[model samples]
Target chain A: MYGGGYIHDDQKKKPEMQAEDPVLLAEFEARIARGEKIEPRDWMPADYRRQLIRMIEQHAHSEIIGALPEGTWITRAPGFRRKLALMAKVQDEVGHAQLLYSAAETLGKSREDMINDLINGKSKYSNVFNYPAKTWADVAVIGFLIDAAAIVNQVANSKGSYGPYCRALERICYEESFHLKQGHSVFVYLATGTPTQRAMVQDALNRWWQPIMHFFGPSDKMSQHTETLMRWKVKMASNDDMRQQFLSMYVPKIWEIGLTLPDPNLKKNPETNQWEFTEPDWNEFYEVIKGNGPCNAERLAVRRASEERGAWVRAALKRADQHYVTPLA
Target chain B: MNIQSLDPRITRLGIDAEEKNPDQTLQREEHWETYQVFHQKKRGEKHSSVGVVHAPNAEMALLFAKEQYARRGETVNLWIVNTRDVLAMNYDDYDVFSTTPEKMYRDPAGYKVNDKIAAYKKAQLDV
Candidate 1:
């Protein structure tokens, strides 16, 4: 649920290297064509491994980073019920990170390297979390709207080719469904409770609207060529399509609840059956990815401090002479 | 990371985990391998993997998982399974696990007994 649609497409394709083994590549591709899931020991093209690693590493990074914005509110949650639920939700996010990191490890990258890359600003996460959560109502908006958006993405990705990640996501999506319910409950309380409470929720939604739209990334016309990735089931659904699907499903629900979207242009087109809306600013998205967002510095600083503080415990618990057992699918 | 892959002597380098010795043997790899956590909320129920935990050993993993996952629930039994010990086949072989559509023979719905039952009732009434 932590992932967004902004896929970083910077992996340089080595056509020559992959072309060296056409027969094996064809066999690998044939398996994929037959709706076969790829295992860690499966004979896949080098680029496939690289692309999967990059995507999964980014996803794992997003889960942990995404926790930061929500984790801050645990202590400030209004009541015991809200506090307990928020703490569990945040812990679930961190557990997802742990699961995702393991799934990525099946591709050969260690969790340490991924964290280092994230902390050193050499990697990316979801663009939405860079914005600050300015109010308690922001928590509601994140829990309901943001989580709803992630379900759309993760449910699609759960049918992906990688066995480990798909399994991890299957469990994750189950937990997220409960999260959505919890979030919806909180949102309904705010939206229907009091005049001030209603205003707070509306104001929070207004602020979060742009980031939510940007969550799905740029348009398909502006997208990178993903034909091969799609055929391989690496990229399950396109960003624009996911965005359209999210809007069609959630916009009416928002209105039915007596809340409104910030974008007036957000509506479904009858003829094309596409939801039409003003595109979010890709320039700001790219800028935020470059580490200039409102909370990026603070986020990384906190992560750095945590790693240092937890170093001793990790050291004290270290063991030697281990065996690498193949993980279950 | 699996510490078993390292030579046993590697532990002698120092307590400092960040030791950057020139010899590769002295290097330490941080991050524990993932262990899947399963909890049975009540006795006699099947255990299900609720989440994952990372720790140096299985005992520690169980403890960590108990604290992180079991606190909010009524857990009666907890199981910590190393992801490595779980053997997963390729998803291309997924048909082995599917029991839908063509597998109606395994369910009571597969039987069509309405007509037979009606004939049996009529025969009984006549007798």
Candidate 2:
């Protein structure tokens, strides 16, 4: 059992000497142990660099696209304060994407290339973002629960092996604190408001609950990537462990607000010191990841429309550069 | 001196010296090249660089910067400058400062204040 209190039932393999030059591997491991951040110009394994680029770029894309769902409700917010909060939250997501993309660029990928990949649908973002934010309550639930789930994962990533990613997460985590509070406040208001407001809140919670559970990824047993991720210290915690942390922290909060979680089977077990919850439909999770979610088509279409609309702005900049000339005598 | 009606003259050096080129006459339109964003969190604080945004003009740049950077209610003042207009020291000219020894005297630790503090503490105890 680890200090986090989860026993590793899986067998541990003996640490084999890396097949690469022994001296270099020793140096790499020594740096990691010393808590020294690996900068862009520093030497790293090709696989390490590739993995960081892929992960960071996808995270950036998610933030950029993730703005769309909640951005739809900014105008419809019931009060001036709510509207301002929604706008600020969406704007923060955009800023976060810029910071993340800048970090990914440290890995040698160009912003243009990553943006192209996202536009052409060659890249994947967090699957939770594909679902539509149908109502103002949905926005509240997303901020409260979806953002909360993201905060849990991001808090772990703040300790990521990549230095820039960790640094960027510092700012991101601070902003997310405000977001989580705003979300919780909105949900509380609705939960305590008129029957219609309470019903809307409940409906949003029901729709978002399963997706939140699935946000931690598939179970540890099925995660083939976990072993390598752990070996490299890229992912310090297992998927199941992160999921358990989310449930334990959040399930009670949901109940405290006088709302029921969608999973009737969910309860804390005294013996196991763990929450027993109905397993989310993994098939649906996979389906969403594969672009079969309810709002996948609509989300992609909206992104494409925005990109197309902004084409003129890019073209105008390019043309403006052509007009520059040195003053002549 | 008729300006537009002046006869074109070729200089002895064989250059077109007299003809004013219409291409040169029309001043190039200057577009907003870049914006430097500053954020002030409170009323009395100095604004600091949050980041920069590229735009077509100052007005557009300010709008974009507000939307992109200050949407979080974090800015009270913003300054936008054309990227080309900002004069910066060239790295090629940076060799002038290379001859000086590393300035250790400017560091607070270089003063060795710990000994002074200890001596003062001992005097007070003696008193």
Candidate 3:
């Protein structure tokens, strides 16, 4: 009824009419069952297209905004190698954003519209980046833990039903692995360094722990969108399942470095064969998604400023196209 | 050739002098509109045509191609060419040969090369 069509109106159709034009739902189900990738030109259910666009566009927005938090550290990196690595990593995020935006463009949304939506706060990016990067150790935590969480989600998306999105994720996942490794290397160095360095690492970890837990969203039972997404093969795993996978892979490594997670309830349960941890505060996540995060204003301002600054470049390119000519004696 | 009419920046670096007069320069720039992009997946390999990018100039063409085609790490080398320079045969002009029957002799699979090679090897062994 919200979009103008009644949900129960189809029940009034006669049985003879329904039997004549049997819905192609079975064909769509069979296509998913065969593990076939649905290309852009192929026919698909309207909801599947809507879901893919929402997920992919949000992903593109996240990559673009995610660069700002890390871009702040490029000038302050200690050594040449670290500086170069950070710069390259930030550039890669820009490149990844471009790739995803192009994929989303193929789904009927223009890049300009998507970008405008982001700047106007009509859409949302990953809530993790909305948290401030307080110290140098915060950078390492983001690269390691935040990027690690992203890798878990990306790995699942690499096998998604959409052909171009799947192909794009394959390359993105490879680059994310490098970012995770670099972050982990920095954390390991700090963890084994002086008392102050260890303390910095611990403090950063404490601030990030809650956001990392909330990264995967609420439990599967609570998510209304999860069932339809799963049935359409757009999402292969539930949010809670992916969160547990992240914990299983990361908890031991955190413990090995002799650092404590902020959550007091975090432990390995032998009976369930899973890591038991405190649930993240959903209210905070809700607030962040509603544009109430600490860095939301700053992030939007930076993006808008950059867009304004680059207007001259686009104008120059356009003008050169019309008036360009060869020189003569 | 009216060089003074164009933007001063275009003429500042003497890039315009490398070409012919104004008309020829304009013609060449117009001719250079189509660009073919080649991507080298690995070092020391021949570049292959991945796609084409269009622009008004060579520099912008290459930049556009890089953004449009080679953001991923699969490319090591890229070649951009003007589409005007490429010579292609027209299908409409080749009607005499277009409907010809399949030529099995041109295919190795149709000739049973494996059996023939096996027979040759057997002959050599006998010898």
RMSD per model, one decimal? 8.6, 15.4, 12.9
Candidates' lDDT values, in order? 0.78, 0.69, 0.69
- TM-score-superior candidate, 1 or 2: 1
Model 1 - which docking category?
Answer: incorrect
lDDT tens digits, residue span A65-153, model 1: 88878866776789999989988888888878877877887788767778777766777888888887778898999999999999999
Identify the leading candidate in terms of DockQ: 1
Question: What are the chain A TM-scores of the candidates, in order?
Answer: 0.95, 0.88, 0.89
lDDT string for model 2 (A96-186, tens) is 8877766776677656567666766667788787787778899889888888878888888778677877877877888888999999999
Q: What lDDT does model 1 reach?
A: 0.78
- What candidate 3 gets wrong by more than 4 Å, as runs, is A1-25, A222-225, A319-329, B1-38, B43-58, B64-76, B79-127
Clashes of 3: 1
Which lDDT tens digits does candidate 3 get at residues A1-329?
A: 00000001112331321221125666666777799877665566666776677678888888888887777677777789888888778887877786676567557665666777777776677888788777778888988888888888888888878877787787688788889999898889899999999999999999989888888777757345457667667887877788889899998889998999998999889999888887789898778777788777666666665565565555555434443221100
Write down the C-alpha DockQ for each prediction.
0.13, 0.04, 0.04
- TM-scores of chain B, in order: 0.65, 0.49, 0.48
- Poorest stretch of ten by lDDT in candidate 3 chain A: A1-10
Best by TM-score: 1
Q: For model 1, state the Cα shift of residue A84 in Å.
A: 1.2
Models ranked on DockQ: 1, 3, 2
